[model samples]
Target: MSGKSSWPELVGVMATAAATQIGHDRPDVAVEVLPPGAPLTPDYNDHRVRVFINLSAVVIQTPVIG
Candidate 1:
């Protein structure tokens, strides 16, 4: 799935988790492999080049404070 979301943080966190599950095991190495001080989160449309993981999003909203 090609995932994009209004919540880039959610995407980033999930991406980080996915990486960790697969043994990348470091947040920095998970998101971007280019160098230090790269973007803290991937773009909404960005799937990792090496891994070819497509993250097509399906958002369902619920009130957080309801």
Candidate 2:
């Protein structure tokens, strides 16, 4: 990922990956994940600015398999 990328883009990437994983097991299932909030300080590195966005995206995109 590039530094100029937006938070939403990062989130979308994660979502896509999660969706792919879900599709692997349940091809008929559809996943719709959403971000909770901005990324926290610990979620991103010091060189990143939109860490909150990325973090939030990751949280939202994470799959909950049971």
Candidate 3:
């Protein structure tokens, strides 16, 4: 009996967990301010941010064969 949730819920949970971990690990990372009317670029988005984190040794892993 697996206690798995839906995809969106799982994503939310994982994001929350990562944020908690980051906060615990490094509390000095400041939130950057974006200028108003800034173009919505994928390069400046959360997914890109996550990718950067992963590449920079922030290690985000997902379960395999779940």
Candidate 4:
């Protein structure tokens, strides 16, 4: 079976932990932590996971492989 492709549980988790978990789950993908309101490129990359966090460094958006 395939590994985790999405992280809904990490929504309220810390940004660092979320990133670490994503990295551990999908080692091939690059994990990028984005601050709230940050500009995101329209381009899509299968090898990337964007972790959107709030000012307190807490994940506000569910991280998912793109």
Candidate 5:
């Protein structure tokens, strides 16, 4: 929510996950149900489920000697 925090583009994430599961041909309907910080419950579409995966990771980098 904070500008300083690099919160990922949530809507896009959901949309993409939706598309991945259901295929790109599916309409962009899931986004309407997906409000900011809304819970992607089991009842929700498969696409929404995939989007949740984006948060299932942690990115780390090793320090460079430069």
Candidate 6:
């Protein structure tokens, strides 16, 4: 959990793989796979990483710890 805080390379990866990779890197945080434009609270969390995906279940944005 002391490595990268963001995964820009995972943008085009599959959601499941992205989640698994993120989880392995930051087991202390929660990884949430969500579709783009999904409703999300404005509050930022240090223990959370949101993986935004497209309709094909492919990550559309860089997964980052907020």
Q: Using lDDT as the measure, which candidate wins?
A: 6
Give me the overall lDDT of model 1: 0.28
Tens-digit per-residue lDDT, 1-66, candidate 3: 223111222232334454544444434432221233434444432221231123233323431111
Per-residue lDDT of candidate 1, residues 24-62 (tens digit): 322222232222233434344233322222343211221
- C-alpha lDDT of residue 20 in model 6: 96
TM-score (all chains, Cα) for each model? 0.20, 0.37, 0.29, 0.91, 0.20, 0.92
lDDT, residue 59, candidate 3? 25
Between candidates 1 and 4, the one scoring higher on TM-score is 4
Instruction: Check candidate 3 and list the clashing pairs.
Output: none
Q: What is the lDDT of residue 23 in candidate 6?
A: 90
What is candidate 2's local distance difference test score? 0.39
Which stretches of model 1 miss by more than 4 angstroms?
1-13, 24-49, 53-66
lDDT by residue (1-66, candidate 6, tens digit) is 477799999999999999999998889999989986789999999999999999999999889998
Every candidate's lDDT: 0.28, 0.39, 0.31, 0.89, 0.31, 0.91
Against the true structure, candidate 1 reaches a TM-score of 0.20
Sort all candidates by TM-score, best to worst.
6, 4, 2, 3, 1, 5
Residue 63 displacement in candidate 4 (angstroms): 0.4
Which whole-number lDDT from 0 to 100 does residue 23 have in model 4? 85
- Shift in Å, residue 55, candidate 4: 0.3
**Which residue runs does candidate 4 get wrong by more than 4 Å?**
none
- By TM-score, the better pick of 3 and 4 is 4
Off by over 4 Å in 5: 1-23, 31-38, 44-50, 55-66
Candidate 5 local distance difference test against the native = 0.31
lDDT of candidate 5 over 26-65, digit per residue (tens) = 3332322233354644453433223233343221221111
Report the number of the highest-TM-score candidate.
6
Model 6 residue runs over 4 Å out of place are none
Q: Which ten residues in a row have the lowest lDDT in candidate 2?
A: 44-53
